[model samples]
Target: MDSRRSPLGRAALLLVALVALPAAAQGKKPKEGAYVPAPADQIPGYSAKVMPCEIIEELIPPRVNCEGELLEGKSLRELAILRNTIFARYGWAGFRKPWLRDHFQKQPWFKPNPKFTYKLLSDADRKNVHFIGVREQSFTERELRRMEDTIFARAGKVWNDVYEWKLKDGRTVRSCAEPQDPLDEKEGCTGANCEGTHSRDCFFREEKWYRPDPKFSEDKLSAEDRIDLGLISRSLGSFASDTGKLEKGAQASLDRVISVQELRQLSLRDLRLLRNTLYARRGRPFKSKILQAHFKAMSWYRQDPNYTDARLTENDKRNIALIRSVEDEFGGPLKDEDWLIDPATDAA
Candidate 1:
């Protein structure tokens, strides 16, 4: 039998009810006012009031327009030049010296100012005078002639004015100055504080020996250091504030280091949760390198020491594999072997 009544049968019943029922009751509408939800008795079936559905366009927003940070032009060239120079001259250890040995040694009697300024000097007059050092000090030729000679010989025409002439009374005096232009009466072509046509070409080779700041200035690590370490990304800073263990509420602060995708894929509870396992196994925080580390750890664990513990399981491997697979799909950076695995232990 049909569950619904026929239209003709329903129409006849409706006509009869209309004729019998009161017009005042049928015409009245519910009052509009603020009130609590309908009581359980008042509603039929489910009592919970559900809002009507709203239609939203199925389209997703365009991907973010952020451009990845670009490296500096000059910085790249300078780094290449430095690398080439280092390769040519031993390694970084050999390149860094001089400043570490003797930082700022000055001749004791070097002159700060000359007794008389001369626009022009005869060959004999020029030979007699000398500038031993900064601060108006003078040094005897016998004291530092060998060292001065070595410098002049290496520089060639670059050290024409540099000389340590002998004085009367067995006291030797040295100019310790740079080679000056004989024709123009200008300072030496290349030496301390000497600037002229040829000065611009002179590189500050001596200054390179100064110890550079070990801490990263910008990216928290130089490109070379990152490359060498096989680190996909440099750490923002040391986790020093919390000391050995992460402080309470520090996990939220460290959220910036781990991306949302990483958090979703990995079952990490908090910052401290990854302390021993993550750091010891993975070393540095590389997006997907943890997978390889996990695999390596598993292989080792299947052996003697780890197998005896009986804590290793197939579930753990599955979870780690999922994390790695998702990380790969997301295209996050992975740490190189140098960063993810400790060389002393995992050299192979």
Candidate 2:
């Protein structure tokens, strides 16, 4: 006789069915915290046991553990996503924050390893990581701004006391100083050797020297100024590519005058200064047409494609007219006097 068909067995079977059915289906509601895990394969990985979500601390090239052993291949970004997914699926919320922080601090992408870091990445890893974090929405705007400021501060410190000199041999040398003689005191002039052929003067007297003004320390520079200084330092070589024709000090002077914001605000005098500096560097006339073309190509200029004399302010119109007049003259090489002569006076 089938036990399930008996009255007592039937009652037990009914009780089991009632308990197993979802309460809502039985005309009642299920309580909260009744989550059930989906199948392991339903998670992102092919096999959850061998998911690509492990990080080895202090590795030269970052390694991940997809299975039993740590292996190198995936990027830190890829590993981060895998770890985030694993933590979310496994309900390891508590581990995610600390794990992300530690990973960000130590990862080769965030901080370069002495041996394993790429040459291109050595100086730019922080910026690269910050950009990635911003793109991934991992960092807030305020957090990114703070990081940017910190980077600027560190860079400013590096350029603070730096100085550059152009030797008579047409080579440039840069160094950091702290109110000390560029040469050692042991090399100082003695009366006996001061006029001698082997004197210290023999080495330095012929070479040109350049140094930061003793009064103008890095701390005295505005934040914008420091940023400008850093940019010039990085781009100095590129700017001085035509140094063969450039007069002494032209590159350094141009460095002081050039900046994105200041370019838009350049007065006629400023433009003249820039043109003269370029002329001195190129050993050729710096034409007004070239200056106008350069100005038109600036980001500020391109921001308004419909730019015309009608749109220009009175001062701007005057500046434009002055530059154009100089270009129209097509006289021999331009001289400093050419800029000093007012266009209005010539028109009259």
Candidate 3:
């Protein structure tokens, strides 16, 4: 292998190199640490009009790789598609889950091998499986943040960017650009304009999906909103203030107030979470596996060695005491369920 070689040595080296090329092309097993997926090839009569399996060995892909949809946006049915697609990428159990098999059977790249076992799963596979499973029971940081925004959005409350607007005359309108049809400028605005939005003409879209309420106020929020807002505030730190950060979360929780009406909206289990979230924010860990696992799932949760009840705000203390009183009426603290582990949180 020396670079300084005789002409005879060079010729012998060339012969050895020529001998190795054919073996590689002929599909000789590569040395250890070099593993390539079996080339996606046709299996005659294996599937009706096949293409390659779209699933590749990738990490817990962003949004778990569900097209354009974020992970939180993925419906349960969509999640099923992801799980089945993963399995189908490996050993597709033919005829068993025909609906599933038939779905990917048309992919020409899909090469099913019945010899599939847990041992064959790549790190990506294991992490994806666990991540997806855990997420099914809990919300990730992104989902939590979105849910925080959505709570206000559902109440017709608008922040800096209002896509739709409630016109003065009771006609719901848009804030108001992005016209669909170019022929007429009045198409989106209906020829009228709404207040201060970037788009002068506020046209009502056909669906009328997001009509902002002009009269939306904290006092007018539904009981459900009040409870949820409080719960989220307890988890997150605070609401939007003069600093121009996110303008979200519960004022009742922030202002040292918790109402019986809000408490009624939560279950005994949720009552426990609403209570513990205050502790969780200060880096306190939970003795219960349920609470520990649940809080650990949240990205914002940090275990603090110096965490103590004294770290809690006056509002936090008041909310905790109020929630605890309600829990007592229901026969004391609940045995937390890993079930219904969905919702979200943030302290500030």
Candidate 4:
């Protein structure tokens, strides 16, 4: 018997040839999916190879529940990407806003499927979506702008500040200033932190996501966003109470060193009290009637006729100066004399 010419020998050689053909032709082992990229002519009017939709999810690593430290420092945009990309992976396209459809479509691997639907999301997908949604509530935009703002803020788009406080009278104000008409209005800074602008130094700046448009208006948000905003307002019943207080509830300023990062979370209105709070701690007389009234309300505030900066702790001075500097940067230099007044003196 000649083993070289055996039927088994021929079949074994054929199997080896089949296994090695692909790798040999490509000069590398096939990837996990062995996905074939479309050629220049493979996709209409394209001159370069494009990846198939099957591998788009591979661009970003999948998370396990997207929990804890995984989400810790992630920016609002990053979270949106993590959550929405799951939908994009299944060809969900964009929300009614259309702000993001081009984003996923621009990806070489993206190939939209008409059959995509929310029902297609897996249990794991729903969990990640819910997790990101809950974590998103902590951000100022989400808290102030409601759910739809989450999508807009991530794209670095600026809309008129929808969050406004209604006065006892018919007047309305936003960011402590009168609300401007959305039509025929100029874009400018509103809050102490320029909450209205999309400057690189804005809060979203940390994540390099802010791309504000001076002309962009809240009217630009989708009808769906407006509808959702209305439903949210109705559900909550009323916003007569300023939401800002909830953010600043008893936050410490004089006790420890404060960082700019921590300050970034605060509204400018909060920073105003934070700096003044430092002075109030030493029983320093506040000339500003508002400041005086605020200190009077605090149980800890004991006005000392002889209070002086000299009585302040080293930490207090540093914290005060830091808070003042940050405030001035956001809200032009407001002289201390503007807020603190000299105590009255009398001849003996």
TM-score of each model, in listed order: 0.16, 0.18, 0.37, 0.26
Error of 1 at 242 (Å): 24
Question: Which model is ahead, 1 or 4, in terms of TM-score?
Answer: 4
Judged by lDDT against the true structure, how good is candidate 2?
Answer: 0.31
Give the range where candidate 4 is weakest over 10 consecutive residues by summed lDDT.
339-348
Top candidate (lDDT):
3
Q: What tens-digit string does per-residue lDDT give for candidate 3 at 1-348?
A: 001233344345434433333223455664564433334244322221211222322322212233333345653334434544444555544422223445566766566665533334333443444344344335444555555556566667655443553344545544345334322333444322423334211222222565667787776565445444444443444332211123333333345465765564344545677788777877897777657766775776799877777888887888789878866654455443212211110000
Top of the candidates by TM-score: 3
Worst 10 residues of 2 by lDDT: 339-348
Report the alpha-carbon TM-score of model 4 versus the true structure.
0.26
lDDT of 2 by residue, 1-348 (tens): 001133343344434432343333346543565433234456552133322334332332222233432223332234344433322332222221233434334432232222211111111222222222222222222333334333334333222323443334544444322222333232432322224323222222233552223354345445433333332221221122111122235234443323333332222333343443333333332235423332322222232333333543454444334543443332222233322221101110
Candidate 1 TM-score, true structure as reference: 0.16
**Residue 2 lDDT, candidate 3, scale 0-100:** 9
In model 2, the runs with Cα more than 4 Å from the true position are 1-216, 221-260, 285-338, 341-348
Deviation in angstroms for 101 in model 1? 44
Where does candidate 4 stray beyond 4 Å? 1-253, 333-348
- Tens digits of lDDT, candidate 1, 1-348: 000233344344334432442222245442353112223343222112211222111211111111221111112112223222211211112111122112111222111221111211222211111110000011122212233222222333133333333333433333454334222323332333334322211321233432323341323333333221211111111121211122223223332243334333221211212332333232333234333223232212222232321342444344345444443333321233212111101000
Ten residues in a row with the worst lDDT in model 1? Answer: 130-139
Give per-model CA RMSD: 34.7, 27.8, 19.4, 25.0
